[model samples]
Target chain A: MQKDASLTTPAAIRKLVRAGDYSGHTSGFAPGFVQANLVILPKQYAFDFLQFSQANPKSCPIIATSHSPGVTDMPTVGEDIDIRSDLPRYRIFKNGQMVEEVTDISDVWRDDLVTFLIGCSFSFEEALIAAGLEIRNITEHKNVPMYVTNMPCQSAGMFHANMVVSMRPMKPADAIRAIQVCSRFPSVHGAPVHFGDPAAIGIKNINKPEFGDAVTIKNGEVPVFWACGVTPQIAIANAAPDFCITHSPGHMLITDIPNSRMAAL
Target chain B: MQKDASLTTPAAIRKLVRAGDYSGHTSGFAPGFVQANLVILPKQYAFDFLQFSQANPKSCPIIATSHSPGVTDMPTVGEDIDIRSDLPRYRIFKNGQMVEEVTDISDVWRDDLVTFLIGCSFSFEEALIAAGLEIRNITEHKNVPMYVTNMPCQSAGMFHANMVVSMRPMKPADAIRAIQVCSRFPSVHGAPVHFGDPAAIGIKNINKPEFGDAVTIKNGEVPVFWACGVTPQIAIANAAPDFCITHSPGHMLITDIPNSRMAAL
Candidate 1:
């Protein structure tokens, strides 16, 4: 879709997505607003997932959850946000496997489903860019490279899996500044987990990522890794839930909350 | 002297230093209080030095300055703080070179002298230790390794010199945590300026530091460097004023201010 001044507001962007007009990745729309990763599961698994999110906040920082099971509206993040159809796209998971990708899940919506709004890297990336640091993946026009690490998340009931992290390369000086800037917004992965060698965290290779395309790591640049929202999706798959839903990779749910409100300081 | 419970207070420690009963380094003394590096100069150079500090804050963070030239007391930082005798030891500089190391500078005191109190690493080191990160220099009983870097500071009038950085080695994860904790105390050199390769910041050998004893950089640990308070001393030496006084290396001015008061948050 062509970028325009009218599409700069979160309300406008979500209106487009809800009307089945813009179903692509919501990467650069509504610049100053927050965009979140979506996760929906049955009521039977809600308590365990909430506990898991609390335990591994860096990876699964929940911005808001459905007021109650069976509620289709998430009033906390945006006005009149329909949990079933507001996001541009979502993946339906059946028995630990993704069965279908669709623009809307209204047809499969169930009364007992619970929705969670998890924090995304886009918020901190905006803060970094505002602080005058270049985000490599954004500059290269690619999704952030992600890898599964040996670090295990605290298990909550049936949920258990190793952490998944997203990588961004920067000079050591820039990395220090990035840490300072990102530290202000703990809800969105906070500071980087590791910055130098990938092998220390169990990643076999820097160039080959398990998800998303690899960006260039310039000379003198170290690969800085942050806990990724994809981590929760891995845990859901490992649990083998009978029914689950998540925003398709890169297609996030735009929220009315301004990103600046997320700064802890 | 033995570190008795009574010496834990800054006032008690300063009383001993003031009486010439203790002329040794002040490390590990008055544990929870703020310690400051002292710089006394003629009124002629005060404005320029203040500008230099504003320009290079990370290196020469000013915690407090004398109310005016010739003022012997600093009511802002401590009670009855006699600028001439409160510090454990003072270094007298003549024509930019060290002339004498003495316990008291009252004999050479002049009405034209101005005193500056710069934040020292001791405050943030306490914070880092409290956060459960091991400081290699403290663990090994050595002064933090300081290096003269090629990075130039923004010059103000006659004051101009390269930045000096203090190094602490830690694993990547610990370095990230250190960055978060140190960012809270900007007055105490704040967060690290660089981490990982020492050569990236112009340090030729990690094992050899220009000032302070070197600590071991264990395997899997990266050396994190913070802007050092010693940077101002280098600037003073380069300026080559007619006369100046500074705290002796590792001997600081214990302040009435609690270290927690320095947190920017």
Candidate 2:
């Protein structure tokens, strides 16, 4: 998969994914644009998830949502985002367990299904890279390591779980600069949840992350952690409402909005 | 003695000081404007001091400086400002040792003296107060507690010294908010340098600070430390130039610019 050449534009990439031509990971695709973590739920659980996101904005910054329960086109984020088939892959869950992975969910899409577009780390990562900081996962060609921490997310209704965090190894100096840089982009998991020790957050092993591949931790680098998009997924898994769908890991929905537009400052 | 009533405007206060009518501290005076820390040096050392300030901006953010060697009017910060008599009191130092403290320095003014206006904590203190955060020094009617730290300032030319920091006791939650608030106003000794333990920065005694009066540190409150304007003063002391003049402690020059004008964001 030539990430640089194939996916230059969001609409062009979405067309390929919709046509079943491309179905691999979407990291490093559509540079300078916002990519989102997708969460599709039945109308019965949509209100609870929305409330959960509102309670924990730093962990779950909601970018946009479907206008109606069945409406798929999120006109605000991009031109024609068909929530059911635009993504590269979808994971179908039944009673909180993954049932199957499918290319399109049009067969299972119901009239009462709702789609949520949550802000992902790609935007802020681009900002950090632009500021001349090296991301360990990107450099090592591995997924950014993620861990489920003891820090619990504020529960709204039946939606509740402990927060999940993504880790990036950086020296203390770069970590300080990263804090200042990310503080400006509140919509994309602003600042960091914790910096230094892994045990402080109840992570027993720095090498064994709960999700994503472990990247190299250099000599002077401390693992800097940010509240991850996987948090809402964890909450959804806990709630487990009959049926739900989400993009397979790394198959994000790229939007037309540029990454810089997300900076709150 | 009535701080709120005595100093209504910058010009009026300058007039009173010029006529030898006011000779006290300017801490509570000029309620809603910028009050600066003054350091006057010979023309030979002006460029070096300016470079030091530029290198250590968090400690010494320069608001304005004398256009030339002996010119008095700092028309940029205030109008018709006689740097000799505008400040309440001036300390004349010969080879870095204090020789005299006088209400006016006109008779001793030289052609080679250069004036610098460094940003003081008063502006951000006002902002913190407006945000409903209590300033311990202001509440207790004492000078803000300051300490000499192991952290060394970037040296330039003959100017070099360990950094000085001012401490304010705040709960962890309040400290986080303070960091966010102070980040907006970069000129006025922005965001804290270190928070949790004083020993981390080599401050042996938290209760007994090196420079200013000690304030109460309540239960569950961690000492938040900011890079102090005294940093430049310490550098100047180390440099020990032939002669220098500076505003007496707490006797700053009240500038015409409003405090709100200093916020970078």
Candidate 3:
């Protein structure tokens, strides 16, 4: 799908996604808006999931949850949003494996479902870019390389998984600036968890990532890693709930909240 | 030579230093209070010196300046503060070279002198310590290591010199937390300029520092550097005006203002 010039605001973009037409990566789609990672589970698992997010805020920062399961008017994040079908794409899972992919889930929407919007890296990436720091993945025109780390999440109920991290290579100066800029948005994976010597965090090879494409790390540049939104997905898969759904990688749910609105400073 | 119990408050400490009895390192003295770096110059160099501080704020963050030349009291930072004798020790310089070291400058106090209080690292180090981060220098019982860097300060009139930085080693996670904690005290150097590599910032050897004793860098820890208050002193020494007086290393002006008062958050 090419760029949809008509989809200017997040509402317009969501309207298109709801109408079953636009299903592509949401990057560069909504310029100043907050893009979130989506997770849908049965209401029975809601409390445990919320606990999981609170315990590991860096990996799974819960921005907004459904007011009550089944009703989806998130006035705080959007003007007229529907959790069931407002995202560009979603992956459906059954017993720990991805079963199918879809643009909208209105047909499968259920009253027992609870929607969670986890803060995405797009928000912090936008901040870093605005600060004049170059993002390695964006410059290389490749997916951000992600790795599974040795760090374990504080398990909640049946959910248990190791952390997944996204890598960005930068000079020490740029990395320092990035940490300051990213610190403001705690909801968006505030600050890097680790940098330099990938082996320190159990990343055996810098070039071969478990997910996304590897970007260039120059001589002076070190690989800075952030707690990834994908960690919850890994957790969900490990738990292997009977049914699960999450936004397809890079296809986020763009909300009305401006990126600047997320800054704690 | 030892922690003085009688010097309980900034006023009491000032009185002792004023009476020529307590002349020693101000660290851990008057706990929870602000200990400031003192810089006094001839009136001819005040405006340009202030401009230099304003330009290179990270390297030379000026918290307060004398209301006007010839004034001895700085009520903004402390009440009944006698600038001429409050600090434990003063270094008198003639044409950029140290001419004498004295406990008090009242004998040579001039009407054409202006004083400035630069924020000290002790403020943020206290905060980091409170947060359970180990300051390597304090842990090793040595002065924080300092080095002259190739990064140049923005010159103002006759004031000009390369920036000097202080180094502390920490694991990557601890370094991230330190960044967040130090960010709240922008008056005290704000965030670090660089990390990971020493040569990138023009430091030839980590162990062989220009000022202060070296601390241990553990197997997994990396040295984190901050914009040292020494930069302004270096700039002043390079400028080589007719006369100047500054606090001796570790001899600071104990202010009534609490360390909590300096937090910008």
Candidate 4:
């Protein structure tokens, strides 16, 4: 492990992760900074995914995409971001099926590969915590409960999926406050897609989540849901492109931007 | 009605209202402009109300307030907006009870009066309508149904009340689109407070509203409720100051600012 792995700066963490020393979840590593979900695609599908993200911002809010295809460093998000190696792990998909997990993709890096950095929930979760709201998943030390809802993302080109939402159990008042706070950060799955009843969005059971671990639900708390960045992952999986790459779940690219900067206000 | 009653700009409308000529609801008059919910109080109560608004932005979003006590105009929201008579009507409250509904309050105007202009849902409703979402009340030509919710507004000093929400029914898809559209306009009661079950928010009867006329909830439509400007009225009524004035229900003060200007994005 690198000496600076514990440091909260995105550059230091990316350096440690890039050197093949740390390949684990980036959660809790870089507090107060924006952590992004990574998506690498060929230039051919770039416009379609961009259009898809534009149409469905709540699910796939793009913070910064490569200025042009084959560009490894996104000057806007950080100082030194080598998209091929900065993330702890990458999932290589062949026609939508995960084929391999690697720390470095430099060998397969193509001049036509386009990198997209999406806003992650970590930014807004920090905001919610700052506002004194208890995040159930954080308290339980578990991944947020995620469900595959019947709600469909607006189709753009070939990308489409029933939206995947991450759930946080909160009291109604806390949920209202979360809505106000999260609404200010549109890039990070702004506000919530649904709340109160799971069945309303076609989730049959509250105890069983399709992804992530379920946390304890208190007496007064209702499950508040946000459009997850995972929705695009599911869409990409469904589309089954010839070749694609993504950051492994929970392993995000920590960016130099402060979480406060993500706030649209 | 005067020849330019509908044709007049917000400044002209306020000018006419100031001169004690027009004394009707300001709706449908300023087509592309903003309308405000007026609350004028003594300087002593200003900080508390501002705190209350900051704490509960969804219920009482303060667009522009008197820069200093006794300032008659808010240069940010309009030009020459006289705090006393720009509104079509004003309701005088003593100990929280409405004592008079008058066209003008020049007689009661004091040196210490601090005026607050709150964002009204009319601006966002215009945006929603432009986005092709049907506003039930507008279509039925009735006041939007408003209900007192069990949800409490965060208290600041002496200002607090249960939140009041206005309802508009729409199909699930339209409701989703409305959410996205309203999310862009935070100042104007952005997004629905609660949707689906009114009972969730302590609303007992869908048809029986505490304020405004109840519109039909069509077969496939659900009642989407928004945190209303009326919420502050309830708080003000509960707080019951020695002297208070508000715009009469539906008799808003239209501003020269366009509705699009309120979109935070």
How closely does chain A match the true chain A in each prediction, as TM-score?
A: 0.98, 0.97, 0.97, 0.97
For each candidate in turn, the interface RMSD (Å) is 0.8, 4.1, 0.9, 4.4
Q: Rate the local accuracy (lDDT) of all candidates.
A: 0.94, 0.88, 0.92, 0.88
For model 4, what is the alpha-carbon lDDT of residue A216? 92
Which is better, 2 or 4, measured by lDDT?
A: 2
DockQ-derived CAPRI band for the predicted complex in model 4: incorrect
Q: Estimate each model's TM-score.
A: 0.98, 0.86, 0.97, 0.74
TM-score of chain B of each: 0.99, 0.97, 0.98, 0.97
lDDT of 2 by residue, B141-212 (tens): 999999999999999999998989999988544665677778888888887787656876889998899999
The ten-residue window of minimal lDDT in model 4 chain A covers A1-10
Clashing pairs in 4: none
List the lowest-lDDT window of 10 residues for candidate 2 chain B.
B171-180
Instruction: In model 3, state the lDDT of residue A113.
Output: 88
* Candidate 4 per-residue C-alpha lDDT over B1-265 given as tens digits, one digit per residue, 9 for 90 to 100: 5646565688777888888887888778778899999999988888998899999999999888888888787888889877777888899988888899998888998889899999998899899989977888999999999999999999988898999999998865576567768888899988787777788789999999999998998776778889999999888888888889999988998888899988977
Cα deviation of B135, candidate 4, in Å? 2.9
Instruction: Give a tens-digit lDDT track for model 1, residues A1-265.
Output: 6679888888888888889999999888898899999999999999999999999999999999998989999888899888788899999999999999999999999999999999999999999999999999999999899999999999999999899999999999999999988888989999899989899999998899999999999999999999999999999999989999999988999999999999998
Computed on C-alphas against the true complex, the DockQ of each candidate is 0.88, 0.22, 0.81, 0.15
- How much is A90 displaced in model 1, in angstroms? 1.7
Comparing 3 and 4 by lDDT, which wins? Answer: 3
**Interface root mean square deviation for model 1, in Å?**
0.8
> What local lDDT does model 1 show for residue B159?
100
